[model samples]
Target: MKVSIIMGAYNTAPTLPVSIESILQQTYKDWELIICDDCSKDNTYEVALSYAKNYSNIRVIRNEKNSRLAYSLNHCLQYAQGEYVARMDADDFCLPDRLAKQVAFLDTHPEFAVVGGGVMLFDGKVVKKTIFNPEEPKKEFLARGVPFFHPTIMMRKSVYDILEGYWVSDRTKRGQDYDMWFRFYAKGFRGYNLQEPLLRYHDSLSDYAKKSSWDMTWGATKTIWLGFRVCKMPLRFYPWVLKPIVSWLLPKKLIYIIHNKKHNGKEN
Candidate 1:
C-alpha cells in the first residue's frame, strides 16, 4: 500500500533537512512526503522546495498566512494520495525501518485504524531516554497522557475522512493531537503501539521553556474539557480538567525533576 507522510513545517529551517533525509533513507519506498509550510519567516519554504525538486515523490506547499499545525496539516491532506497517512514533525528523526515496520503491522492487523511506536527522546548530542507507549489505549487514556506519540503514528487514510481531520480551533492550537485522539476514540476507532522506539524525537533539555508558558497550559485545559464532553466521559473525570492548571502551577525545575524521576534517564 502507498503511504503519504504529511508534515507541517514552521521556522525549523536548520533542522528540516535532517528530518527529510531520515525519511529518504526509509526502507519503504512506496511513500510520498507532503510538506506544508505555514508562512515561515526563514528559508524553510525554499529548503522544502529544494527537496521536492530532487525527489519526485516529495511535494511542497506554502500557506499564505501562518496557520497553526491543525490547519497546515489539513492542507496537506488535500494532496495526499496514499492508502495510509503518517505524521512527521519537522525536527524529529525517524529510524530507517520505521515506515516499513509500521506498514507491515497495519497490513496484518486490519482491525486497527492507527499504529505508532515508542519514541527515543533526543537532545542535540545524544538520546535522553526512550518512552514506551501502551500496547492499547484505554478509555480513560483521554484524561491521561497522549495515547500515541504523534510523530511516530501511521494511520489509515480512512480515519481522516471519518474524523474530518483535526478539530481546528483555539483549544487545538496547542493540543491538536489530544483533541483528535478524543474524537477518534469517541467514534470507535482503535489504535495500537509497537513495543520499541521507532523515531528520535527532538526534545531538548530546555523543553521546560515551552511547557512553562501559561497560554499553552490554558489551551490544554480547554482541550481536555472539550475531550471529556466529546467522549461523553463521566462527571468524576471532569475533575481531571483541572490537571493542567495544577501542572502549570508547578515550578519549571520541579517539572523537569519529576520527569527525570519518572523516566529515570532510561527506558520508561
Candidate 2:
C-alpha cells in the first residue's frame, strides 16, 4: 500500500534536508511526500521546492499567508493520494523502516485506525526514549495525556475522511494533535503505539516551556472537556481535565525534572 506523508514546514531550513532525506531513504518505496510550507521567513519553501523538483513522488505546496500547523496539515491532506497518511515534522526524522513497519501493522489489523511508535528525544545529544503502550489506547489513557507522538503516527486515509480532517481553529492552534486524538477516541476509533523507537524528536527545555504555556493549557483543557461530552465519559474523569491547568502553573524547571524522570535519566 502507498503511504502519503504530510509534513508542515516552517522556518526549519537548518534541519529540513535531513528530515526530507529520512523520508527519501525509507525502506518503503511506495510513498509520496507532500510538504506544505507555512509562509516561513526563512528559505523553507525553496528547500521544499528543490526536493519536489528532484523527486516525482514529492510535492511542495505553500500557504500565501502565515497559517499555522493545522492549516498547513489540512492543505497537504487535500493533495494526498495514498492508502495511509503519515505525519512528519521538519525538525524530526524517522528510521528507515518506520513506514514499512507501520504499514504492515495497519494492513494486518484493520481494527486499528492509527499506529504510532516510540520516539527518541534529542537535543545536541540523545536525551531519552519514550515508549508508548503497545496495546490499543483507550479514552482513560488519553484523559491523562496524549498517548502517541503526533509526528510518528501513520493513520488510515479513511480515518481522516471520517474525522473530516483536523479542527482548524484558533483554539486548537497549540494543541491540534491532542484535540485530534480526543476526537478519534470519541468516535470509537482505536490506536496503538509500537514498542520500538522509530523517530527522533528534536526538542529542548525551551520547547517544553512553550508546550506548558497558558494557550496550550487552555487548548488541552477544552479538548478534554469536548472529549468527555462526545464520548459520554463519567464525571469521575473530570478531574483529569484539570491536569493541563495544573501543569501550566508548575515551574518550567520542575516540569523538566518530571519529564526526565518519566524517560528515566537520558538513556536509550
Candidate 3:
C-alpha cells in the first residue's frame, strides 16, 4: 500500500531531524513524505529541502506566506498521490513499524475508514505520558470527538474526498483535530486505535502542560459542549468533570505515569 505522510512544520529545526529519521527508518518502503513549511522563520524549510533532495520519497514545499497549520495541511493534501494519507507533526517521531502495521491493517480491513495508534508523549528526553483509545463505533466518536491521536492517524484518501477534508472553522485553529474527527464520525465512519505506542509526540513543559491549560480552556469547553451535547449522545459527566480537574491537579509527569501504566500494562 502506498501511504503519503503529511507534516506541517513551523520552527521545529531542533527536533525535525528526529522526526525525519523516524520516517527514513520505517520498515515500510512504499511511502512518501510531504512536508509543508508555513514560512518558518528558522532554517526549517532548508532542512526539509535538504532531506527531500536526498530521499526520493520525501517532498518539501513552502507556503507563499505565513499561513496557519490547517491551511498548510490542506496545502499538503493537494500534493499527496498515495492511496492512504498519514498525518505527522514536525516534532514527533514515528516508530519504525508504524507504517507497515497500519498499512497491513487497512489492507486487511477495508471497511474501516481510519486507523491510529497509541501516542507516547515526551518532553524531548524521557517518556512523559501515553494516550490510547480502543476501536470505537461511529456514534462514540461523533459524541465525544476524536477517539485517537491525530498525528498517529492513517486514513484512505477516498475518505478525505468523501468528508471534504477538514472544516475551516475557527474552532479548527483552536482545536481542529477533534472537529474533523467528529465530522468523520457523523459520516458513519469508524475509528480504531492499534493499542501500541507507534508515535512519540513532543510537548514543551510550559506550553503543553501549563500555559495551554489557561489558553485553551474556553476553546476546549466549547468543543466538548458542541461535540457531546449538540451531537446528542447519551452521556456521562465523568469525562467532562475530570478533564479539567486532572489537568489542574496532576503534574504532567503524573499524567504520563498513569497513561504509561494503563497503555503498557506496567509502570514506566
- The TM-score leader among the candidates is 1
Cα misplacement distance, residue 68 of candidate 2 (Å): 0.9
Candidates sorted by lDDT, best first: 1, 2, 3
Candidate 2 stretches greater than 4 Å from native = 263-268
Per-model CA lDDT versus the true structure: 0.89, 0.85, 0.77
Q: What is the C-alpha local distance difference test score of candidate 3?
A: 0.77
lDDT of 1 by residue, 1-268 (tens): 3999999999989999999999999999999999999999999999999999999999999888998999999999999999999999999999999999999999999999999988988877898788876788876877776888899999999899899998788767778998899989899899999988999998764867766678888889998887899899988788889988998898877877777557411266
**Candidate ordering by TM-score (highest first):** 1, 2, 3
Q: Which candidate is the best by lDDT?
A: 1
- TM-scores for candidates 1 onward, in order: 0.95, 0.94, 0.83
Worst 10 residues of 1 by lDDT: 259-268
**What would the TM-score be for candidate 3 when compared with the true structure?**
0.83
- Candidate 3 ranges with C-alpha deviation above 4 Å: 141-145, 209-215, 235-268
Residue pairs in candidate 1 whose N, alpha carbon or C atoms collide under 3 angstroms: none
**lDDT for each residue of candidate 2 in 21-115, tens digit (9 for 90 to 100):** 99999998999999999999999999889998999999999999988999999999999999999999999988999999999999999989999
Show how many residue pairs clash in every candidate, following the order shown.
Answer: 0, 0, 1
Error of 3 at 141 (Å): 5.7
